[model samples]
Target: MNETKLRDEIVGLAKSMFDRGLTFGSSGNISVRLDDGWLMTPTGSTMGTLDPARLSKLDINGRLISGDKPTKEAFLHTTMYERRPKANAVVHLHSTHSVALGCLHDVDPANVLPPLTAYFVMRIGTLPLIPYFAPGDLKLAEAVGEMASRHHAVLLANHGPVVAGKTLQDAVYATEELEETAKLFLALQNLRTRPLTSEQVADLHRRFPQNI
Candidate 1:
């Protein structure tokens, strides 16, 4: 999509998530790769009330090109872009369930989401947990960069989730899936849940190498 249209679509989708309580206040950010740079939501801008024309535009080198200032977490997006050439979009959200799960010390760092459903396996693969850095700290970006080449999505411990995809819509969908899976995992705690077996998971990985 062209830059203007892409910006509008991102804002709309972000607000939809906000309205549904996926995120609240100014707690989430979204960005799409542009030919020249990137189109991103601004700092302190609530996802539920984003104005497309006011979206921040940054040059390829991370300089401000237009609109309002980019989010403090802008480096998180750029770092992933720099490390993962195929990631054309990034979505970071403080979705309740996912963040809550991240706070748990027992959550597996290698696989933050449980294999509760096939869609989770197909969309998110295995979500690694990156050690928490204070919000907006460049260290967080560095941590994400370290794992960018291997994982498409990660749970930022005690923070939230970050997901990269080939497009803006795909990133958004994957993040939503992550939250849903996290919610299910939390709900099924100590309930004798039936997670996918190792053989099934291995078969899935074999079939969808990209997801693995």
Candidate 2:
């Protein structure tokens, strides 16, 4: 898609997430790669009210080329773009359920979300839990960069989730799946649960190599 159309679509989808309570306030951001660089949501901008024309535009070198200033976590998006050649879009959301799960003590760093459904397995593979860094901290970007090669999605402990996909819509869908899986995992903690078996997980991985 062209830059303008991509920006419009991103803003529309982000607002839908906000309207559905996946994220609230100014607590989420989205970005899409462009020929010149990227189109990103601006800092402190609520997703529910994003304006496509005002979306931040950056050059290939990460320099601001036009529009408003990009979110402070733009480095996180840049890190993924640099590491994953197929990642054309990134979405980070301070989603309530996922962030709440991140705060739990026993959440595994290697597999932050459980394999409750095939869609989750096909969309979000193994979600690593990176230790919390202050929002917008360079260290957070560095931490994600360190894991970018192996994981397309990660849960920032005490924060939320970050997802990278081949397109903006794909990124958004994966993020929503992440949040849903996190919500299910948390809800099932108090019950006697039966997760997918090792062989089942292996089968799913084989079917969706990009996700796993």
Which candidate number has the best lDDT?
1
lDDT, residue 52, model 2: 89
The per-model lDDT (C-alpha) reads: 0.89, 0.88
Model 2 misplaced regions, further than 4 Å:
none
Candidate 1 error regions (>4 Å): none
- What does candidate 1's lDDT look like per residue over 72-122, in tens digits? 999999988888788889999999999999999887788877788887887
Candidate 2 lDDT by residue in tens digits, 33-144: 9988999999989999998889999999999988898999899899989989889999999998899989999777888777888888888878899998998799998999
TM per candidate comes to: 0.96, 0.96
Error of 2 at 172 (Å): 0.8
RMSD of each: 1.4, 1.3
Give the clash count for each candidate: 0, 0
